[model samples]
Target: MPDAPLTQVLAPDVSPRPSACPGLWRIVTARDGGICRIKLPGGVLLADQADAVADAAERFAGGVIEATNRGNLQVRGIGADHHGLLDALLAAGLGPREAAGDDVRNLMLSPLAGLDPLMLLDVRPLAAQLLRMLETTPRLHELSAKFAVQLDGGEGLAMLEHPHDLWLSAVRLEQRTWLAFGLAGCPAQQRALGAVPVEQGLALVRAVLERFLDLARPEQSRMRHLLDTCPADAFVAGLGLAIRRDAAVLAWRRPASRAKWLGVLPQRQGLALGVAPPLGRLTPAMLRGAARLAREAGDGSLRLSPWQSLLLPGFDSARAHEGLAELAALGLLCSAGQPLARLVACTGSRGCAKAQADTKADAVVLAGLLHQGGPGSVHLSGCPRSCAVAHVAPATLLARAPGRYDLYLRDARLPGFGVLRATDLTPEEAGALLDLPTEHLDD
Candidate 1:
């Protein structure tokens, strides 16, 4: 389907329930300025599109582009010229197929969907069908902007931790491929409610969504909310389609993926270079430089990962190092060993009113003090919201006041940022504590 023009899609007033989240049409106001989220299809951004986003950010917004956790890009600190920013994006074919479809296009796929050497299936084709179904179907538009679905191809570098309203993973059964699905959870921690033949994947998705719409009240915006009252078994039974619930399907669990997203990554055909913008914030120059490298040395496209990074696929194995060098020179984090690369921080007091501290700056300071042998990942959140990360990190620094935070270590036995270990500690104190051996921190 062709994308709707900016003029045709600007009427957010017509919607029954307006979204607070930033969309192509709905520019949400914030402490800095305005925010415009460009929902990319499967996180695939072409070189030209990347250039357009850079130009748009530089022209009409604070030149800050963010790689969102949902595998999308958002322009932050936008100025008064919302229409001008929307126009430049739309002209680059960034808008949805229909005016009402903008907020409903929330499907996620692996960054290496088609090229992963270990993938059991290529999920791109089915992902395209599912996205079109979500966008073109007006009934689905009534869904919340936060409603999301994940389609996993069993890639080695996949993000299986982020929870989704609905998730499907490719599985091999009886010499045939099937999609094992669950509701209101992630594949890494949730059991599959049922399985459907690969051919019926689309039909299964449509059935689940339509059933949700039929059963949900206006207040129950997310699938988890509805499941709190309705049983998962009852919901699956009502899908009105043949589903496999046998032991083989029910006991299937997605294997934990240990593949790293930074530096050179593996692809079936060629090497891929993965780089991240420090603290998930990308400047116009960083974006433009990555796009230029993609056009020159890669497949002319960049795939954003759920880890708040970008991957340039299809680079020759020999040129991967050189390509990584170019990206590193442009202020992109090309190696995971970089201290800043291991740290994740939200927009602190500078951009969010709720933030108690400047988490971004604090992260930089904390990164330098970090030792090489502590927790692999640490998340610095301005407040309890922890909006920067969908999944809890190995260690968390929750802000209590300016430059002071409470430390939490991720423990599955506890909930909400895991077990709180210390409180009212400055970054220096926190760094000293974090540098302790793993056994000591665990104790």
Candidate 2:
């Protein structure tokens, strides 16, 4: 438990390390108003907590809630009454156990961490221990708010592209489950540095964190930054843990997942229904409706996914389809075939001072244009920051002006949004080009 009471810790005057990112207590001002981000443990939100968030957004803010790419939720368009909002959320058990822990509670687990039929191991227990250690350890509060770790259970529905400062992935070797880990990258792309027994997972995590704090300079806040100076091999060698660097462990790669985030999804025992808010923005009614359905049809809980979506797990196989229909009726995107589901956009000029165009509005127009062609997923960014997505999309439309963009295609051979294909084109023009077949667009 934290040394201070919840009320005392959430006091406005309790200053934490200054950062631009918003936390439960730290409301960062934006063009839309102050934004308050509420981090969820393993992205799980109980039905009651969901109701509390919806109530807070409607009562204190503009009722504009956003599902972040990191499987967390943020209330946007906030007005004054930050205290009132914080109080409501804290009372609902949305805030961290320790106020200082708010910034450091950045462990990401698969939406189906324990429910996936193809998972190598159920990572929920180890994930809980890691989260608790991160929250209670005052020394670890020094970690940057943006610093994050990922625990992969080898679930078929995991998000494997988002890079983390430290990533631990489940791998089987010699008929035993061991955790293969990498630094500053995701399991889908990076090779493992070594492996440790499943029972020693907690010890491995603690040693790695302590070693990082010992070696990292103030400027080197992220693992990638530190690794630029200290080699990854050197960093691993100093962890002082019994690690297996055998060929089998080093050569193991995470299996490719064909799991989809929208519509009905298969679980180990039952079915889970997935839905998304168009453009990742959820209205108060939308959230309240989902919460109500969660209570009636599901397990009274919802799991936010890395794809900026929601999953209602533990549903009876018969009721799952009906639940999906109810969610879709609430204006949620329940199928990938929905044009808006295939498009992602950041808060554009309307809500962000740095934006040059209105991306959310433009995405609607672009979605209409691509409806028939069904070109793969496309990301529309108001600027170069690309705040809406952690990984590159198959195609990108970088906003240049109010109604124009620069288009790029993902290419493994190139970096930073891949190859620039066209510039200063309207959404209509970009859609026309994107509607072509893959080979034609590449040419």
lDDT of candidates 1 onward, in order: 0.90, 0.89
Query: lDDT by residue for model 2 over 57-141, one digit each (tens)?
Result: 9999999999999899999988888878887898899977456888989999999889999899999999999989998989888
Q: Cα lDDT of model 1 overall?
A: 0.90
Pairs clashing within candidate 1: none
Off by over 4 Å in 1: 1-5, 12-16, 439-443
Q: How many angstroms is residue 284 displaced in model 1 relative to the true structure, after the best TM-score fit?
A: 0.8
Error of 1 at 300 (Å): 0.4
- 116-222, model 1: which lDDT tens digit per residue? 99999999999999988988898998899999999999999899989999999999999999999999999999999999999999999999999999999999999
What is the number of residue pairs that collide in model 2?
0
